[model samples]
Target: MLPRLRHAAVVAALVCALCCAPAGATYSIVACDAAGDCGAAVATHNLAVGASVIYAQAKVGAVATQFETNPQYGPKGLALLARGVAPADALQRLLEEDGGFDGGDIGERQVGLVDARGRAATHTGAAAQASAWAGARSGEGFAVQGNGLASAEVLEAMAEAYRGGRGDLSERLMAALRAGQRAGGQRIGAMSAALRVATVAGGFQDIDLRVDAAADPVADLARLDDQFHAHQAMLGAERAARSGDAAAARAQRNEALRLSHQWDRIWRRAARLAMQLGEDERALEYLGVFASANPVWAREEVDDALYARLRQRPQFVRLREGLGAQEPGG
Candidate 1:
């Protein structure tokens, strides 16, 4: 009779623990675009969720590891995808190899993946059910996963947003995150968020942004994304100009000009593009803006070949002279 009583107590304790486990987990999406770039976005009740939950490699793949997060799955999963393993097969191997993962173990993990070719996969372990809500959804070029959410609807909202959203890979990820938040995000509310897009063309450039702690992390992340928005337009302008799509170039240039004002570094890019496009007056104006924002750039401009055409211009000569005058009592 005592043995039966002890068993009942043990079972009760297990049930209580499962229902009341820590709820500070994450919701995330991983995706790859037609350009073969990979990226991830994540938000959570915990601090700096992006620091550990997201992983990606340019033209390789992306991974979102949350719940009982095992960061190793990120790089390893990326390597598997790079080797041409399907997303589902890569996840299976990750679980098989994690047999010795002492912390949290496989059952406590939830992950999503996407390769450069748009193949996708996801997993929600049994232990993930201990959280308030946990699940994953996968589609053509993206996978969405979440845990400790207010409701299962968060996962569905993310998947729907990704499928229906427009813009680049990063924008789609952001759209999905916003949708999840509207559907009911992390059960206790989000403390942090992050977004990362791996570079295409041999990993030359990437977009990595984060909102470490905030009253409204997703909103803050969106604010931060504005900087990259301008940067993307700047790159688009350069590409369009190079390809001789003058109308496209003008529109992209206007976008970069309109949005990049708050981000001083983009002035240099605008100047470079203007110079390449033979808009010398605009180039000189942008260069002046760049120099004003970053004083050190004043001296560098005098020697840069990109500005050679303007070197002999009176305005530039005075600008160079001003640098020397500002130096000592010249």
Candidate 2:
């Protein structure tokens, strides 16, 4: 668990109260991993919660806009964090631009921010406090906030879960969302959830997901998270292979293959990459798997120019002859 740390007065006040958000970001957290990953996770009773509440850049920071949300805070805050502004200072500057620091546009908005260095700041506006419950808590690397929730315990549980979490930054954020749900989420019952984590700060998000309309957004999001990791491992395998890290490529490839059997396209993609890596045998193995599960798709893949090298192989000939293939190792 990450250690608790004292925060600036901005976080001292749940410091923001911007404008009314069209849809809610009922409870959320923004954080930075010691590994230079930064992200935001949010669950709300709103469609496409991800489109509204969370923003992150790899080595920069993450921002969560809550209550009467202010959309600009995300990009603007990140820009500030990226420019070397501390989280507290960044939040203040955002507020200043939105209106005036004393109160400005701080209607019912709330915000949580964490810079790449683990510095945190969070603030909930007075307007937001009028809701059933609204507040925020911050520590060394995270901030959790909630409004119109069952109680303050929601954010507290999020903070606890984040601190106790392990593994990748995305996984930890998901754990926190689950914990918040367990503790009693939104007053109206959460209808949506989102999780985003960047492995390269401003680069493509390593894990970006949303459950806009589900009976249980948290559970749905969990399933997506698991599948996303499998895809991520597959990409990792390709990267390792391309970089000439044969051992790493093999290990990640095996993991991807193990985790991706249920995903119809993963095997074909894996096979294509394997062929490019000069692993003819491995390519044959994965293509066999894809063909067994999706014969129609396999036919297209086998004919693709990427597999031209494997065209004359006896095994390839056999596979093409029997598109109705059986599972590999059979």
Candidate 3:
């Protein structure tokens, strides 16, 4: 009799604990451009949910599966989309395959899908936490979803931001993420955030950044995006120089250098660009900064033909000699 009573008490305690535990929350947005460039941004109270909750494949689509989240849905969903499955049908197939937390009911899962064609679909499980006020909204070329949100307005604001924001797909998606957070975001706040954008046949992502954990993940994510853009400008400078647009190349290189003056690679590349543009003094200045930051790069000989003219300059010779003197063996 006593054993039976104790068992009942234990079960009751377990039930109470389960009921009191806080539900996890995630807010996410996915958008596609007219050129079929797809991108996704997500913020969650959980660490690195972006890695699992947001999945996107170039020329296919983006997926955000959350709320009692299942990680497998990411890759599998993209694969289905790659196979030419419609967004709705792909989501349904995921539901069919996984069934649900229970036997066959997905009453607690929240998912959003957007294909390369800009077709979108969203689902919010009926059983999502009430405090979260789970909901989703879809627009012309984007979808926003949230679980454990402060209210339905969270997703609404995200959708509105995506629709009204200016700039490219990444900018619009970031604007939506900021809007969702301002609209209350998750009741518990955010710890992790991510942004990923893929261009059609571009062979590489335009933006891929993640803030795994931070006091202000969204802000950190924005900072990362700024850095990414600065780096992209540097790449543009390189390409412009290769294409014989010296004036455009110089402007782009200067812009990147202004944004990130401390980075060794940017300085090195800028030095080379200035040399090619016949800006000997500017090239020497850039090389000085690069050598100071990266002693190893100074020790290596400049082999690029673009620097042949600058290499004959007295300042260039002195810079290399100074670097060699600073070497360990020297």
Candidate 4:
């Protein structure tokens, strides 16, 4: 009778464990191991979890709480999830508090707190599938993805990566996710991938890439991977256009447009700069190219804007007169 009761107890425990296990889900992160092309290359977007908080409070750079939620867990940043709660009382208020939730179903709560200076923190909990799920934290910022994931492992790893990650924090966070996917991500499938990398000093300003429906998460990550380089090309074009040298600006603008069709804006801006430099012929050619490549730019507003500023130039008058009369496409 005793043996039977013990066996029943063990079975019940096993069932509880299985019931509490987290379902596969999604989170955010930084960077990615994207394909070499301009497809959907990986971008940095990490979900800040735990008692940890990252901050860029001063010019000295960012700082992180470096809280280790579960010492018994794997590596320093392996598996962790942080709620508004903390391991200690005094440090509790330092975490970001978020009762609001988004994404999928709430299971394991995790966070990756990061400030402008690149600081980070992490926290986790033992609460699994209670009557309800609620989480909050302070100090560092929070990125709450409501859905519960397979385990807190990826979030914890991402936190560690963000804190100790070399180079760009966002990029390193992407690399960390890549590592997690390899370790055994959601046993099911990922519906989408989203990334958000924010910083005052970073080149790309608030660029977001989302694959709402992809057969392969990694493939989508790859697509996001290339977007970064294309983004760089766009920025470079902007810089070149701003440069005083018209020739240099043209070369950069051409390269920028080559990387992504969206960069045609930079090309138009370059054309404006060329016109300002008294390079009216070159400006007309650039504007003509911009109009041809990006029909949206061929609007009357753009034409009027440039023409309004250049009526005094002889080349401008000739260019205006020859607009519809010259060239096959232009």
TM-score of 2: 0.72
- Note the Cα lDDT for every prediction shown: 0.80, 0.80, 0.77, 0.40
Regions of model 1 farther than 4 Å from truth = 1-19, 99-102, 202-204, 235-250, 267-330
Best by TM-score: 3
Q: Residues 300-320, candidate 4, lDDT per residue (tens digit)?
A: 424565556555666555544
Give the 10-residue window scoring lowest on summed lDDT in candidate 1.
1-10
Model 2 lDDT per residue over 1-330, tens place:
011212422342354334443333399989998878888889988777888779988888999987767888888999999899999888877765764333344645688899989999886766666577778899988999888888888988999999999878988998999999998898887788999988863434477888989889998888788777778788898899889897898788777777664676778778877887788998898888888888888866777778777777999989988975343333
Best by lDDT: 1
Supply candidate 3's per-residue lDDT for 171. Answer: 79
Candidate 1 lDDT by residue in tens digits, 228-319: 78877888888999999867876887787776645667888888778888889988788778778876865765567787777679998787
**TM-score to true structure, per model:** 0.72, 0.72, 0.76, 0.43
| Deviation in Å, model 1, residue 143 alpha carbon | 1.0
What does each candidate score in C-alpha RMSD?
Answer: 6.5, 7.1, 7.7, 11.6
Candidate 4 accuracy as lDDT: 0.40
Better of 2 and 4 by TM-score: 2
Tell me the tens digit of each residue's lDDT in model 3 across 119-167: 8887665454333477788877778888788888998989888888987
Ranked candidates, highest lDDT first: 1, 2, 3, 4
Error of 3 at 143 (Å): 0.5
**lDDT value, candidate 1, whole model:** 0.80
